[model samples]
Target: MEALTTMKKKKTRLVVRKGNENIALKVEDIAFIYRDNTIIVAVDKEEKKYLCDRNLSALEEELDESMFFRANRKYLVNIQYIRGFKSFEKVKLEVSLLIPTCNHSIIISQETAPLFKKWINEE
Candidate 1:
């Protein structure tokens, strides 16, 4: 007899709420996920917002690591949506995205700046 091993499949879609309806949104279509006050919101490439039932930490673990980067405590950004990044206030980095976010800016801390650069350059 041979032993078998199994690997968890990464999530391709997320169930989100818009008004009273639950929508099945493709992970590829999501530009970013952010904490807006007490709610967890997922924004698509087109800038539409949906409510997520799970927290950011849970979503980070479930989503593909290569595709999503935990930009900060409040943001989980998609690599496909990153337009560019530049040095900000010396040590920090300001990331620009294809779709605008509610905060208007995504700032990566000095501690995470190097990691962000490496991840962006890898792709």
Candidate 2:
């Protein structure tokens, strides 16, 4: 039983179209995916950031929700980058990330917990 759990580590996969070519990006390779106002950015190896012409919500729809969590209204983060979560207040939490997050500290409120849980449950 424990062997099955150890052997079945979950992973994420993303299918994206770049310059007329279809590229598949593994979630582990992604540093983070964030939103700038309405634009979405996917940062990967070599510190290269790719711009997706879609909004955060739209991009989130294309992603495997289990691996990417919408921490705030403007940011969707990969769980691989999630270091730990701290209970900041009675109904809020501060999430620490593994990567060097520019916009550090995410508050997970009661209102957002369900949505966060849903995202974590998806593929």
Candidate 3:
């Protein structure tokens, strides 16, 4: 009998929509993912926003844990795009990103702050 081991497949890019056009963006180039109404949006380092077909939860599963962190219910932030973070009210955290999103607020819960701290420090 042969045993099957799952391989860690890293996703390099994703195909997203900009109007009627489908564009492939490198995962490393993405700044963050956010929810806007019923749509999921992917923002790049250049601050360009693209419409993603996958929901936030679905995208969360696909993204690398080392590279991305779910800041809240509405945001999945890339480590490469993190500018800084601060302590927020009520034991929460406020994160500032290099690429800004007009519609979403970037904040992390108290429980996730310690984990986020460790992730950012890893080489």
Candidate 4:
């Protein structure tokens, strides 16, 4: 029970950079996090983007897994922003978000499709 509670207790605020300014954004407002070349970016529900100092893997560990999913190597998606998913090229699953991503589609490989399905369906 203690371990579960600790895991569920995620960081409420994330410190992100916007040019020279460092802003503390509420985690709930974040729609997704993605790797853009060498930089990690966080997108909010309003479609605003901010730069994260941490890498995708590090952010993934800090976030509550129940609210976020590793959609692909590039994206850490918030479940609240996911609209739906569909078959992609017959072998993969393509995820659609409520807010559009950075002109790229979120794809789940065939091997990870089952895990993604279970995560999405869980209470």
Candidate 5:
């Protein structure tokens, strides 16, 4: 079990597209990932949004579970970048991130809310 757990590697960086150029960005700098229209976008703490070739689901597999959480189908947010959260629509939660350009809120479903709270509180 220890061997298998140790074999699980965390991604250190990602190659993302910004306009016509591809940029190698540190994983720790990413604030969140989201699906916009047919494109997948990654936002950094600097408030810059980048185009990712991989979709949200694929990004989820590559990201470290300790740092990122899927708020919903549309968002996978970095725990360190989360500003706060508030209760919404009875059982749901609306999460606010620290990124200035990323103004939209991420919502967690009732079914996933408890798990999100646990993740946030764990470390």
Candidate 6:
């Protein structure tokens, strides 16, 4: 039997609160997003944590189409800043991108392969 999957293409907006200040961050400028116990760690050009109570699945819908991509379970990479992809694997792609820290390899889950390709193809 075929697998069941629901794909969504949209931009994610993060509402962050640093003390008493609130800010909105776009998923486009995001370098990579990780998890930290209760908070979702999303690193953009500027360093800050966008507060959200939703899981990765729900957040995926809130994110923009061309800006962010779900690249494995722990990371959501921004396409604008992505240099390109690497073909160093036989099964999945050897994902490489330019995020704040450094250029490193990211894991593109086999399940999300088609969406990732479609995202890159878009101009």
- Backbone clashes in candidate 3 total 0
TM-score for each prediction? 0.90, 0.63, 0.88, 0.90, 0.91, 0.69
Error of 6 at 32 (Å): 2.5
lDDT of 3 by residue, 5-38 (tens): 2345657899999999999999999999999889
- Report the C-alpha lDDT of model 2 over 1-123, residue by residue, as the tens digit: 999875555436565455666567776677667777666777764445666666777666666667777777867777766676756677776777666644545677788876765665565
Instruction: Single out the weakest 10-residue window by summed lDDT for candidate 4.
Output: 96-105
Report the C-alpha displacement of residue 114, candidate 3, in angstroms: 1.6
Candidate 4 TM-score over all chains jointly: 0.90
Instruction: Order the candidate numbers by TM-score, best to worst.
Output: 5, 1, 4, 3, 6, 2
Q: After superposition, how far is residue 75 of candidate 6 from its true place, in Å?
A: 1.7
Query: Mind giving the per-residue lDDT tens digits that candidate 4 earns over 12-106?
Result: 88999999999999988999999989989999999999999999998998888998999888999999988999999999999988985546588
Which predicted model would earn the best TM-score?
A: 5
Alpha-carbon local distance difference test for all models: 0.91, 0.67, 0.86, 0.91, 0.90, 0.67
TM-score of candidate 5 versus the correct structure, residues matched by position? 0.91
Give each model's clash number: 0, 0, 0, 0, 0, 8
What tens-digit string does per-residue lDDT give for candidate 6 at 1-123? Answer: 223323443545677555577767765656767665666666676645555556776676677656677887767777777778765466677676665566445778677777788888998
lDDT of 6 at 67: 67
Model 3: which ten-residue window has the lowest total lDDT?
Answer: 1-10
Q: Give the runs in model 6 whose Cα sits over 4 Å from its true position.
A: 1-12, 18-21, 36-38, 47-51, 103-105
Instruction: Show pairs that collide, candidate 3.
Output: none
